[model samples]
Target: MADTEEMFLRAKHRTFSGLTEGSCPSTRSCGATAERLAERLAERLTEWLTEWLAEQQAERLTERLGERQAEQLTEWLAERLAEWLAERLAEWLTERLAERLAEWLTERLAEPLRDPEEAERQWTGPFCFIQAADPQLGLMKAWRIGDAVGGGDEWEEEVALTKQAVAGVNQLRPRPRFMVLCGDLVHAMPGTEFREAQERDLKEALSGTDPSIPLVFVSGNHDLDQVPTPSTVEQYCRAWGDDYFSFWVGGVLCLVLNSQLYFNGSACPQQKEAQEAWLEAQLSRASSAEPKPKHILVFQHIPLYVKSPDEQDEYFNLPQEARQSLMERFKRAGVTAVFSGHYHRNAGGCQDGLDMVVTSAIGCQLGDDTHGVRLVAVTADAVVHRYFSLEQLGQRGVNEELRKMLQAC
Candidate 1:
């Protein structure tokens, strides 16, 4: 019993000893040692926690201040730059206005609009209007070729030919008061690389020509981009100015239509109807007026007929009904002629007393040939057309291929 009691005490002491060590008894050295150790741990924890919290707070404050400073700096910089730009713009505008005003004042005092010339210049009796078309200015190979003879292309050769044409037109003694271009003023779109080339060529071609000569343009399908967009048309129209408008030169009432209408699908039928109505109105007015227009001349890009071997392949040839309606209307109005292009070859067919004159393409020809335009001499007495090949006008030879094409034609 004594041994058992002693063993039980020993077991109790072993468990209780571990508990006492964990809690630290008050009278033991272990309790004092534990208290010192706890005090040191508390000091170290407090020091570490205090330092960490201070650093976290400082970093947050610094970041907040930096963001605020950045925003303020950006605002200040924007305001300053805006103010500077505004002031500079205002000053520049003011300077320009003042300069323009000075020029206006000078012009008012010095050079007023000139009065009309009453002096009779020798009246070289009124000449007929020339129906010119498709001066495809930017065509890389605007030349002609022969049918039988295989020859080289002469794109560069025709540049001089074009200049010669312009010079010939200018030197016509008494130039045609008005000229018509059936279209394709530029090779491609109005504002494309082709257009830039065209602008340069035109500038050179018309350099020494008379400014009084009036030019009329009929918008060809190629005049704008292949896509039918208003902006492209507007650009061409604006670039050409009043030249793109319709007006009478003498007794001939002329109308130039935008031929791209044919490519506009169902929209085109409506547009065609509207144009026909407009034409009827114009013809009616011209017919009824005193000193009525002796002739009604219509210029457009695509010809109504090509009389090709494969008639179905003709590009944008006028529909039978539309052509018939136009012819009938013009016949009734006593219209004399219609000038057009887009066949790339000359074709003429007269029906119901009106003459249809289709001009040759000024661009490259499909058949080996020389490309050229027509010179029409119309008077009260008669309308005579003479096809003027550039070679004859310039007294020079065209590309052998183009020459062959011309002969084939």
Candidate 2:
């Protein structure tokens, strides 16, 4: 382990020798690697740039340029050169990390498991939907509120909560054929530790539950960086399978859009266009199908409309343009309701023509709020939803903490 650690440290330090001028910490393996890569890349670019600048300076010096004029020219050239180099380095690092992580993860996740197709054989349902959010796998201990002892060291709390939620769906006596995770699977950033914890939590959570249960996962902003990239979406897709995609549940055509769509302007055009086209195709297909869906349901991470803690920011809100596009698309598709989360508190109603649901977070709650999952039953006629608190299910410790939090809120 020491030798392995040394190699990574050496790589990072050697790679970034001139640029960062900072020492690499041996403790964090991933950080060491990132630092090393950044260092070396910057060093090489800086050297090449210095040479180019020297040539430019020589050319200027040979000319009749004054001192101040030469200095300004040099400065401008250096700034533009450094900016270009930094952009390239950032892009390279992002691509390298994304590719390495994706490949490594794909191999690990490819471990043999019971086939999803095999499990589908036994499923029978009017197809009820189980709604839940904020499974906060790695941060179970961080959910404490005031005097309540809510933190658990083990990742099992998240797994247990998920299992119970799944069991609730399974034992619906009649059984719901599908389940939806509102968002926020891991409480922290999607780094190495969080990824591993998420894998373990997901495996444990889905264990022994009906493998046939179609899970629809929508990405919360936390799931990816503020400016989400294709690689971010790739990571989520690889980990969760095609759970992010849309499909039919009973007679309703459901559109599950990655809510990360709201952020990162550059990444939006393609995603927005693709989703619009996909929705159009799906809507067209549904309309021409033998049995057209009576309703359309959209699942997203942040609610389109929410009661804000602050009026200025609009607490529970969706991006205006994206939200408008979504609203129009769903309306065109005949959508009836939109399910969302991120408030960690519950308050939802109709916004525009669609009923918007601001689901309570299961990981933690604010001010007398319930740590629960919302259960929604939709039919050809109407939609009904119920909040099923884990506390009500006899998880008193969680309930107490959440109650205190809600009261404070």
Best-fitting candidate, scored by TM-score:
2
Tens-digit lDDT track of model 2 for 1-409: 3433332232221221211113222223444455556566666766687668756785766476877777777777777777776677656765675456444544443221122222222222333567787776655555553322233345666777777766655555334546677777766555544466665556556555554444556677667645567776667655554324555444466667667666443665676567657667876775675565667777888777675312233435765666666667666766788888877888877755677788887766664776778766654466666677765533434334333323331
Q: After superposition, how far is residue 174 of candidate 2 from its true place, in Å?
A: 1.4
- Model 1, 138-248: lDDT tens digits are 454433334211232233433555566666566553455555668766454555544666655554554444444444556776676544565666576555542123454
In order of appearance, the predictions have TM-scores of 0.57, 0.59
Regions more than 4 Å wrong, model 1: 1-126, 142-159, 190-192, 242-244, 263-277, 308-313, 395-409
Model 1: what TM-score?
0.57
Predictions in order: lDDT: 0.54, 0.59
lDDT of 2 at 316: 50
